[model samples]
Target chain A: MTPDKLKTILLVEDDDKLGRQVRSHLTEAGFEVDWLRHGHDALAADPSQYGLIVLDLMLPGTGGMDVLKHYRGQRCDVPVLVLSAKTDAAIKVRALDLGADDYMTKPFWPGELVARVNARLRRPLANAGDSIEIGRLRLDQSARRLFVGEESVDLTRVEFDLLLALARRPGVAVERGWLAEHVLDPERDGTGRTLDVHVSRLRRKLGDRAVCLQTVWGVGYRLEPDA
Target chain B: MRLRPRLALTALLAGIPLIAGSVWARSAIERSNAVDGLTRLVLQRMLDGGRDECSRWPESWPIPSGPGMGPGMGPGMGPGMGGEGMPTWEERQTRMQAMLRGGGGPRAFSHLGPPVEFFAYSADLTSRNRLAPALHEDLRTGLLDGRKVVSRGRSNDSDSPLEIAVRMDWFDEPESPSAIVLARQVGASEFGLAREFLWGVTALVSVMLLTLLLSAGPVVGRARRLTRNVRRSATDQYATSIPVEGSDEISELALAFNAAGAQCRAHTDLLEQRERSLREFVEGTTHDVMLPLTVLQGHLTSLAKTSSGEQAATLRDAIEEAHYMTSLIQNLATTAKLEAEDAPPRRDPVDLVALCERVVARHMPVGREKGVRVEPVLPGDPVVVRGDETLLEQAVSNLVHNAVRYVDRDGRVLVVLSAESGRFSLRVLDDGPGISPDQIGHLTERRWRADDVRARHPSGSGLGLAIAKEVALRHTMELTLGTAPELGGLEADLQGALG
Candidate 1:
């Protein structure tokens, strides 16, 4: 791990053993780790001191969901990664709406936890711009404007974000789910249909240069330099 | 052909062949006896008359000189009965008339009502008479044996026209026994009457059979109904037993069937009850077993953090094993639930690409711990299929888990999810020693593992592929196995309907 001087994680877990293990792993990964054994203490903590919060959903004192609500209500901008043992889609959506930045199920690898925490901490600057350009298509970040060879193309919010996510890594494939997570409104169900329609609209907006955004087989979209 | 109607028909039609055959036999015997009786009576009358007329016996009777008639005509025979192999009965009647013309002999055949012709054989049968050589021999033998009774000739009524033969001794001239053969010439009207009588007998027999069948309708119907009841008890699953009406065969059959049905019902009830309890036990046990596995996994995670390098890898392996135990319980519960009549899986649109990714994610850590590479190659677009989401996940997870577990170090396990040929397919291919051809067929059997596989992964439940197969079947999909051409290892493929 390349040392980031400002990195610190507040981990909220109920299990005594799991809490210590996660704290130890995060501490070893060059992040100053603060372990909270109760959801109440996590809900009371100040988010200003931490870059990320790795919270287990099965907390003893305040319940992980309530803790998420508490911090989110207080306008806590710190990323919260909710961990559980199973994929309960309804609960996941609820947690995400309650201000969880990401979801990770239990029994996850230590490397994966660190990666998720790092990814969450590295948000916003991860894109570093409101716009991007690939091939014949260029997106103006500041004005949320798209131009294909100096001509502007109108796009919906989801369409713009979807194209931006793919354009950020021109040749790398973006996951179908990650695209939806970044683009679609967090309050909605965000079924695959909504994502598909957005992609279709975005492609149409790209016009003849739509071929630049090519779908990688067995993966997702990759914005190639040339069609 | 229902059992009842068939049985009734069998009983009614059973006697037709016997009745038809016996009628012909009885008629033949009656005809033969009638011929024998008539011939003997006529011959006896002639012999008695001959004895009485010996005092006035004509030494030389006028022979029929012309072709048909040369002498006096008798009162009975109107004309000569002419055909091959015989002096006509008419000619013989002419001779008898000539003898009786102004002659003083008692008329032997005048008292007889039927018209019959007779010929005498002096010694050898083949010598003088126009009689058939066979008939002549029969008559000669009969005479030497002093047969008082007549014998039937070999010729049937249709062939010789009612022929018979007899031998009698003449008391006045008993030196040489004469063989006499009589051919009775029945009138056309008389023949018609006899035929009418035979036809009447056939009609009467048919009528009798019909009447008997009509009277037995109730009995036959009862037997047939009993047969149907027995069949229904065994096949249609009729609930009630047949009613026993009387101490008869049908009632006895009903009793047997009723007893059999009771035994069958008891057995079925027992089996169903046992299955229900066993399903409950599995569900309860799986739920009870998951808690400890969860805590154990938590402890292992803590241990893995403290440990370094090789020890950490070993801890991760133990954690993976514990995780596998949890999955086994879940699969056992799921299969048990499927076996039960209740708790059917929900049919929903499941995204196969997303599903495969989740399964790959779960097994990636274990693969890393074991030094095998678990790679997921899910399609860019979602591969949607209509099935239970959890079940589809379980199926794919089982495949990916097995791939990671069975593959050698540095081997790659690739999970590919795609929509191909309008079906959603989730394929898990590994790069390891492939399963043998003989072992492929038994891969889906519950807890079945090859000898080498059991030796290699001794702790494996061997139910991973079996659970995958069961889940596939429940989703109305097929789980197929093969050796991947590229990977040179086991490839587990599940193809499901796309929605």
Candidate 2:
């Protein structure tokens, strides 16, 4: 964590009330939120400087879609969450297809928006380095591999994705739904029972180290490395 | 076409030919048969009478005979002759015709009742009485061949043509020139055809009527059933699908109806489920939101009650209301997030020591203002867990706030965090009025079914504990409410595996 390059976000929204509320909420959540009202300003500004972007689709001067298109066309990979009042399912899918990392319908809970932002931000933070370690557990991102102390362990693709999702935010309770989306297919959440099965199998594979996986009943699962 | 009418039409069409055939046969038989019979009788009588008369005549008397006629070679011929003399063939022919013309008995040729006429053909085949013989050539040939011939022709003797025919039979010999012809005028020529047409039409009508009668029952019954079912469905009437009957047009309709009913039922079920869940969410959200709104209203009412003298305190309360508002909104968002099956909550490393410290820090100002000491008893080492960091903070702060609000003005509230036995625990203890015996048992019931708590504590919405329980559940931690043996007050504990 550096002073100049803090975990900051550029938020572009037209609504003053929502803007102030979200800006304050994100600030309280320990992010330096640079609030902007116009899409022109957002587009003119360097998109790569921010760690994340919270964009409202309805914007003045330049439309939000245009800004998104131009920014993504320029290959800016900073995660963007398109926040809008357009609750149509197709619109959300289109935004996602157009490279927006996530879509949140309007009237969203501030904490939920922050949670989604934080989830998206975790990727870069975890992917920034090639490897991560939590006590005896270590992950090698480049090799897509995991190590239990000095003993290298065998893992399936799903196991690796699951361990990676948990290891990236060690000590954090990842929701079962989110874990399923990242570790398995996102569509498999329709029947949540499969997640429980996968988690149990993952814990079995960990054996004596299964303590790292903790069940958060009715919510999801969490990873604790130093258990 | 509908099956009812189509079936009726089919029967009618089938009956037409049958009626026509029967009527034609009866008419032809009645007309031509009588005429043929009379003709044969007359010819036979002429031949036999000529033979008898000739045989009984004296030997000196000359015999006028024709080929194939036996003149007096038979013994029984004596009484049959009009006189014992040979008569001319013409006279004999006249006598035979007179004999046959008399009555309908065996010896009479006119025995064919009414509507019949007699004709005599001499040996040379000349017709008598200006009667035009029907099938003249066939009769002549048949007479020569020793066979009876019958045929039909239309007669114009009356204004309307009568179906008239003749029957002729040769007598005595195959080549005999003597023959008798008979004609009978049946009713109107078209009477039979017209009768046949009438019968066919009648049969067709009856067949159609019968078809309708038969089909009406099932078709109309099924139609009514379908209407009833559709009406019921329209009025939100629910039942199993209408029972399908035999394989017909009606059965297909029923199957289609059943499919529609199933879809409607499924849609209704889905709508009901969605409505129920929405209502639950709204009620829960309202109650939770009301906590802050009530607090704000209380502050407003207090500010309104007091003069400008307590302006500073009122302003502080206002600020407190705003903070509560933000947190209430956050709780709402968290609840909404929990509803989505695909969204994994943001899991970050939660520093329990710092969390407890922060909870103490937030509640300390209010506690100190009330003269209560809010202190953190966190371990020296970093106590961390895996969970949604913001939620954990909110949960711990909620517990601390509960302690601050409930404890006496000068009481002590301890925010405790410790790691032991491969786990970490965060507990908030207060030397305030402890939970009642009844309330303590149900402190962490998963659902918001805490009516007793709301009943006991009217001012508190019990939202704080519910939130703490939710957060603890999210983190897979245990949130327990117990009497602190050391502090002798309510102790709220959240414990989980150490991260």
lDDT of each: 0.63, 0.61
lDDT string for model 1 (A139-159, tens) is 888888889998998887778
Q: Could you give the C-alpha RMSD of every candidate to the true structure, in order shown?
A: 11.0, 18.3
Runs with alpha carbons beyond 4 Å of true place in candidate 2? A1-6, A133-165, A169-221, A224-227, B1-499
Stretches of candidate 1 off by over 4 Å are A1-227, B1-114, B118-170, B173-248, B337-346, B367-382, B406-414, B429-462, B476-493
Name the top TM-score candidate. 1
lDDT of 1 by residue, B1-499 (tens): 7544565577557646655566556556656555655665445545544323222222211223233332223533344433344355466556555433322122432333334444443333321434323454554566567665445432324434454555444422433324343444332223344467667766776676666667678777888788777777667454667778788877887888788888888888888889888767765666545445555655676677579988887887787777677666656655665556334456666677656655666676567666787766544456778766656677788788878878898898877665656876676888888788778877755442223222434366356677678777777798989997658899888887798
Best by DockQ: 1
Q: Assess the local accuracy of residue A39 in candidate 2 as a C-alpha lDDT between 0 and 100.
A: 88
Candidate 1 chain B lDDT trough over 10 residues, lowest sum:
B54-63
Compared with the true structure, what per-residue lDDT tens digits does model 2 show for residues A123-147?
A: 5556687887767877888898778
State candidate 2's TM-score: 0.36
TM-scores for the candidates = 0.58, 0.36
The DockQ value obtained for model 2 is 0.04
